[model samples]
Target: MSVLYALAGLLIIAAVVSLVLSLLGVIVVGALRILPVVFVVLAAVFFLSGGRIDVHLPDKWRRK
Candidate 1:
């Protein structure tokens, strides 16, 4: 009975860890998948506007 309890605890821990890992993996994969689309859209906007767009960033960002 003690061994069964231990096994159950381990399984629960493993499931939690796997769930967290899968969530992180999904976020990373989603970001990677969307990156190309984002770039393409940005490029299209830039080209369509004849490169006349001005991007303004905050001072903190400008410092970086």
Candidate 2:
């Protein structure tokens, strides 16, 4: 639990630093760089919450 908190804190700090650096124009932040991080953060939150996302589709889409 402590480790998880520590990791989450570090991620927050890193995000803050990245935002600051982006504002400073020291580095260019683009979708390519942003997406994986967003995915990772969302996945982590979802995993910690033990939540499931269910997608419903039409029967046509379910068939090959």
Candidate 3:
């Protein structure tokens, strides 16, 4: 749980930084380059967690 949150946070930070850099023309990371990073991160999460993940939904969204 904490690990997933941390990983997600890091990915979001990296994406924001990447976007900022691209806008500044410091680095040109097009969509093609970004896709691999997303896939790799997803693969890492799935593999490292042994493909088991539990998601909890709020009561408001749950089926009665």
The candidate that achieves the highest lDDT relative to the unseen native structure: 1
| Superposed Cα RMSD, model 3 | 19.7
Which digits, one per residue and each the tens of the lDDT, describe model 3 over residues 1-64? 9999999999999999999877867444565668889899999999898897689989899787
Superposed model 1: Cα runs more than 4 Å off? 41-64
Ranking by lDDT: 1, 2, 3
Candidate 2: misplaced stretches above 4 Å?
Answer: 26-64
lDDT by residue (tens digit), candidate 1, 1-64:
9999999999999999999999999999999999999999999999998887688888887653
Model 3, residue 58: displacement in angstroms?
A: 83
Pick the winner on lDDT between candidates 2 and 3.
2
Q: Model 1: which residue pairs collide?
A: none
Any idea what lDDT model 2 has? 0.87
lDDT score of residue 61 within candidate 3: 100
Write the residue-wise lDDT of candidate 2 on 1-64 in tens digits. Answer: 9999999999999999999987767445566678899999999999899988898899988857
Clash count per candidate: 0, 0, 0
Candidate 3's displacement at residue 17, Å, is: 0.1
